[model samples]
Target: MTFHVELDEPRCVASGQCAVVAPDVFDQRDDDGVAVILDESPADDLLDDVREAVAICPAAALRLVEG
Candidate 1:
């Protein structure tokens, strides 16, 4: 199964947890620190880290969508 990541920018609080948990998949904006999706469709091996990032997002702005 493959998963795609989505970010709700308005809901993000710039906690930086997602980037910390999955640097290859998520990052923060240099200015406002908003979450950024580096790889929308992450590799299967990164599922765990992506899942962890989605779960720990302080603002609940991250989601995984099966495609």
Candidate 2:
């Protein structure tokens, strides 16, 4: 199964936790402080880390949509 991740910008405060947890998949646009997804489908090994990021995100800005 593949999951797509997206950021709700309004809810995002650009804390960079998601990027820290999954740099291969997430990044912060330095100027704007917005979460940028490098890949829609991250590696299987990264799934756990991404899920941890989702759980740890204080602003609830990240979401994992299974498709």
Candidate 3:
């Protein structure tokens, strides 16, 4: 299965939790500290971290869609 990450900036609170959970897949913008997707479709090895980041997002801004 392949997974894709999505972010809703308007709902984001710039918490940086996603970045902390998966540094390689996510980062915060220097200007707003909002989460930025570094890798929308990450490798299988990174799926766990991506799911964790999505689950822990306080604003529910992150989602993992499997295809």
All candidates: TM-score: 0.96, 0.87, 0.97
Question: How many residue pairs clash in each candidate at the backbone level?
Answer: 0, 0, 0
> For each candidate, what is the lDDT?
0.96, 0.86, 0.95
* Candidate 1 to native Cα RMSD, angstroms: 0.7
| Model 2 ranges off by over 4 Å | none
* lDDT for predicted candidate 3 compared with the true structure: 0.95
Candidate 3, superposed: residue stretches over 4 Å from native: none
Error of 1 at 39 (Å): 0.3
Of the candidates numbered 1 and 3, which has the greater TM-score value?
Answer: 3
Candidate 3's TM-score: 0.97
Error of 3 at 45 (Å): 0.3
Question: For residues 1-67, what per-residue lDDT tens digits would candidate 2 score against the true structure?
Answer: 7888888888988888998998898899979888888887887778988898888888999998876
Ten residues in a row with the worst lDDT in model 2? 36-45
> Candidate 2 vs candidate 3: which has greater TM-score?
3
